[model samples]
Target: MRTNILLASLVVLGFACQPTKQKEETASTPEKIAVPVLTKAWETDTVLLTSESVIYDEFRDVLYVSNINAVPPTAKDDDGFISIISTDGEILELNWVNEISAPKGMGIIDSSLFVTNIDEVVEIDIPSGVIVGRYPINGAKFLNDISISSGNEVFISDTGTNTIHVLNNGDVRSWLNDSSLVGPNGLLHQGSHLMVASYGGNEFSRIDINTKMRETITDSIPGGDGIVSYGDHYFVSNWNGEVHFVDTAGNRTLVLDTKTKGQNAADICYIPEKKLLLVPTFFGKSIVAYEVK
Candidate 1:
């Protein structure tokens, strides 16, 4: 009987140790996955304009940029304008949309241009440049970038509130308000995730569209201002004039460096049809274009 009891106790101890051993084995297992890298396809030094922000319209094959400066001889009060440029680095229209108050983030949705200015999200007629409507944001002091998801939901980052607000047909509500995101400036939507360029925090965050769960993809992207998705890679630009290419696996590489000065790079737009990258400078007051292969 004593031998049997000892054997039973040993069996129970072995069972208990089995789960701990399995947990240790699982913890020691390596996550085997391939990471993507950027190959230097081509580079160009062709400059465009002094645009503070840029966005690409794939359907129109054009790039839209915002110049955050005083409009010449106008009562615009340093209000900015949007410029439309061709793929070959030609300024199609210098003042695509006029009288915009320091337009920072721009998005093109269904022939309408959505821009964040001051603390409101305004919609403009793309061709006529007429202000169609505006959505007032409460508790938002400084609004930055705007992004549209596949479901036509508009997301705007409120720098002052340290939150991201979602707008659907003029109904505005908070999507994310976390201490981790400080001065969210640039916004982009890829797949079901929203990519944010946190300027004050010097980091980038990926948030789920449905659950709003966020994960910090990278940090210390100084002057993190603009973000765009191209092919299978995501490109982020800093006001320091550095462009980083991040692959699907979240590995980043310094792809292009610009010569602009003092918070120069603000926004980036990828024109896939033309294989071009459009970068806007804030203080340098110029737009730089690069050929991406």
Candidate 2:
């Protein structure tokens, strides 16, 4: 997650309006997509210090939250930790694994949990809660998010350097570093494409895994932090505490906003089976659950 200090100048861009509005129809107008309604289901206590990212483990039926317990997000304090929480918004273990330094995004492949630290990816054995592997990326400034493919390939985003690094087989290398990847933060692997949410600008792009072709789906949401797919639509969050719904036609609608309340929406996770959207408030120190309907 981008620190509030770095994004202090960026004003909140949330609409703070109704979500179920339809545009006037015209002969050449693309079909308007229906935006889902978000209802607050539950919110955790304000105890998760600087919660940056949250991921759901289907097998364990729990949630993992990354806490950057440092002043500056890039600080190598070695005090960062991962918390395990229940689906009902109860934090089970505040420091389930505390050996990481400034841990951010997380992904799991089999029984191994891969999380990005300042400049390296740390793997933990979930079953045993032991540190298993550490893959350091040279020249990596700030590693942010992790997305694992079906083939067990790990993809990580470095926000400070504007690059995406991959861990294939046993080697960690820079995968894509393009001008369009402005502060790439959130990554989601979709079949043959990787959906990227850039923080530096209003850019939501799709990259082909095989050909490395880049396609811009939309460029209207700023401070993009986390992304989740909802059929052909998508739910994207901004670090400034707003969530927007993006349709297949690139139309965006404001679905939720908490900036006015001084809450920060960091990296988010979605559970399709439960139709729940989990938002980790960075400074608010809590996870808010919203029912997607």
Candidate 3:
């Protein structure tokens, strides 16, 4: 009789809590995914010769282009330089910072602009456009893209050696040298995750910052050169003059292509406020902007 009474009381309690639990479940449900589109807005003139990457500064309404005028990207002959252009497609100052050797990709922390030059992270003061310092990785080879986390942790990809190096303040060291990196070229650092675009291996991977767990996002971007986040989608660029849009589910859509023209979309940058994508055409010698619709 006591067991029966207790079971009845438990059933009543469960029923009493049902509505609240349902309400909590509904509140925790994820929102409907967003599908974004893109349209070519306006492209800058073909003035950035051998430009490998583009990064935008909204406060100054300027874009920085990393140009490797040298033939081979691995060359450390100091011919590489950076170009500054206005957002309105005007050349503010060509060869803006001319002290690096093969500056490929760039990131910024506060007023400092950091670029990967050969095997070092070269820091340049944004306002003065002066080369501040260079933090060399002890054994990095062909350092490619750079991405900075919200905490100011700098992560650089070494495409030549299949490694990822980390820089905190002035210290530099190889953080992840896993085979899963597979020629990491373009890096996008989010709050809790790090996304890698493997150009040589032609794959997209995401690594958890805390757990270090890796997952393959996709393998559609052949010659994957650049990656930028947009809403719930990711914009990817191929060195062969193609840009693709990929969703979290691994679905891909070809948004732009200039392969027939022999133009290379090396590294891309996105300005979220203006909904514009800046694409640095390596061989095309141009910085093109596209509108995200």
Candidate 4:
């Protein structure tokens, strides 16, 4: 009987020595992202016709929109044009410059407006509404967005060929033609560097103009078509109808989403003075404005 009591005592001691099991807390909790205040200011009529890029021209105090009216976006059928619109959503000129085909981007240098065509960069006299010069990038398949620096240097992205061509003193040459560019779509000249938004991948990078070095900033916005930075915050638009407001610290918040509505957000432009973001809906054939605070 003593032996049986000792064995039972040992069993009790074994149970007491075992560690208590407590539920573990998760390592990373899903953060509650604040939906930014995206108030719809105004949406233009259906006259834009496949608007791809919308840029605010501070010189003219208006916005220029590139429209591809053809079914095949890359077609050069003399139907593509640029439209002028007021900040209050009025169509100033339905067809501002009617000579270009498949115009995709617009950049200003003095009195000229530089635009990207299928495989060429067309320079137009803004005051005269005439095509002044055409710099063709030979063997370029799809020339996309255009970025002009304060020093009047121009850069254009070729998404089809995965390259970027630069125009220095009216001479157009391929600056960087590597696959590492990763389908560069939107080109933004931010001071000393050029910010690239990759359409083929979900990333944004800053590239050194001289060294061709790249520093990826974020890889959250897939199909990122347009990017603009203001006050340590970046406004990025995915072609899939979503816009993200990302701070310099790499925090992403879904500021706008129109995917459920079956609309698109292509190349967008922002006006810092008015705190407005203009988004071009590709298939929707309209340019929309949202007040960003």
Candidate 5:
């Protein structure tokens, strides 16, 4: 009778230990799955002029790009223009809008398109591509990127000034005046915070619009130029031809690296509906698209 009891106790002990062993095995397993890097979904043929930046419009299903190079060799004009391309990588139209000089980063709000030039912000009418008005900044040099707030306030980065400025009703004020903001290139509005990419500092920062407090989330990125937010993740690209995916908690991992020469991955935009990422390469002279998945 005692031997029989020992056998039953051993069986119960084995069953209890089974769950612990399974738990250990499960805890040791890796949770992060490697996302497969995909080939370039599409690449536009070399345009007549060099392309400097790109932005995607999900509502219109179009990609707007800024071409800074002069088309005619002897035109004696450095006036920049915008180009509209389809998602399939076809140049739908060239010279969609002409007359803006050295247009760079661009953003759309409603039917209005905002573009930054050498020292001013030019607001253009979308369909017509006509310059409606211009906001000029004194002592401002190299207006790099612009982002619009829900309140209709436009935030611009002055790389030369190493400051971020806000424009409301033509009244300009310094939103962030710090040396760490040097070479601020891209701006994106996330919730009530403003995400700024500083190329000179090689960092990504989040600014509380309400409190005016700044927080540096990352400083390890090289050549940080453009940034965009998708869901809970923020994607930032460096001019060195690499893209980094960062989570809300400040964890970052390399998403993509291109062999394309020229550290000029100037701007990037995400189109959620199509799961597409639009990147404009300054040296590549072309816009490349990749599947977000």
Candidate 6:
């Protein structure tokens, strides 16, 4: 009887000590990322004169477009100007600010608007529509885009030299020169990082503001020009007239393709509150608006 009790106890211990049936390892399903559809809402007249970038001024409820009136983009022609348009696509002031040479990307800091030229960052007084300052970046080859950080520091990208220059408190300096820049064109300053759209490698990447470490989000976009955040995803435009919606996992979905139409998509802007996308057609000479659904 004691032996039977001992055997029963041993069996109970063995059962208790036995590992639970390991659940079969299953591959996790990728989170479903919704691809947004873009519907053409409005397009301004084709008189923008090689509009290269469009930025919305929320305070004024207007849109600012940079017109590189000269070809070869790097030309120091004095005809480049900034145009102002109403949110409803009406031309407010065709030459709100002129005399800029090959202006490309622009950002507004408080009452001042900063724009990227060939080797200089021009600061414009928004209310007065006057060019207040021009900060020249030394050794800058082709300054392409401008993004202002929360701290009001203006960051500019140079595609010709794979460099990034910064303007802080009237001081202009070369901030970064990484080979990984690969013709960085468009810059968007997020909270802790800057999103870069590369024209050479056809890549969209992020650079940590603190560490300066570069992380590629995708490399499939050809002639990447503009980048805008949409929730956790992004909307990036190709200089060849293709706009792609990129998910968190780097998967891209083509949202707009104007390549066949011979239209070029340059630096783009997104208005989250209205779910509106503003695309600058470089050669098309127009600002196209689309409602993203």
Backbone clash numbers for all candidates listed: 4, 0, 0, 0, 1, 0
Task: Write down the worst ten-residue block by lDDT for model 5.
Answer: 70-79
Deviating ranges (above 4 Å) for candidate 5: 1-36, 70-78, 259-263
TM-score of each predicted structure versus truth: 0.78, 0.88, 0.87, 0.86, 0.84, 0.90
Could you give candidate 2's per-residue lDDT for residues 30-143 as a string of tens digits? 456778999999999999989999999999999999999875988887888999999999989998998777988999998999999999999999988888899989999989
In order, candidate lDDTs are 0.75, 0.89, 0.87, 0.85, 0.80, 0.90
For 1-293, candidate 6 gives per-residue lDDT tens digits of 99999999999988776654323344367668889999999999989999999999999889999999978788887999999998778998998898987999889889998999998999999999988898888888899988888998898999999998889989987789998778999898998999999999988998999899999888899898988889989999999999999988888889999989888999999999988999998999899999999
Error of 1 at 211 (Å): 2.4
Clashing pairs in 1: 49-286, 49-287, 50-285, 50-286
Candidate 5 vs candidate 6: the lDDT winner is 6
What does each candidate score in C-alpha RMSD? 7.3, 16.8, 6.1, 7.8, 4.0, 3.7
Ranking by TM-score: 6, 2, 3, 4, 5, 1
Better of 3 and 4 by lDDT: 3
Model 1 RMSD in Å is: 7.3
Runs of candidate 3 with Cα error greater than 4 angstroms are 1-36
Per-residue lDDT tens digits for candidate 3, residues 1-293, read: 99999999999999999999999878865555555666777777787769999998767788889999877988888988999988867888888899787999999888999999988899999999899999988788889999999989899999988899999999987878887666889999988899999987789888998888888888878788899998867998988999888887877888888889877889999999888988888988888888888
TM-score of 1: 0.78
Best-performing candidate as measured by lDDT: 6
Better-scoring candidate (TM-score), 2 or 3:
2
* Residue pairs of candidate 4 with colliding backbone atoms: none
Cα RMSD (Å) between model 6 and the true structure? 3.7
Stretches off by above 4 angstroms in model 4 are: 1-36
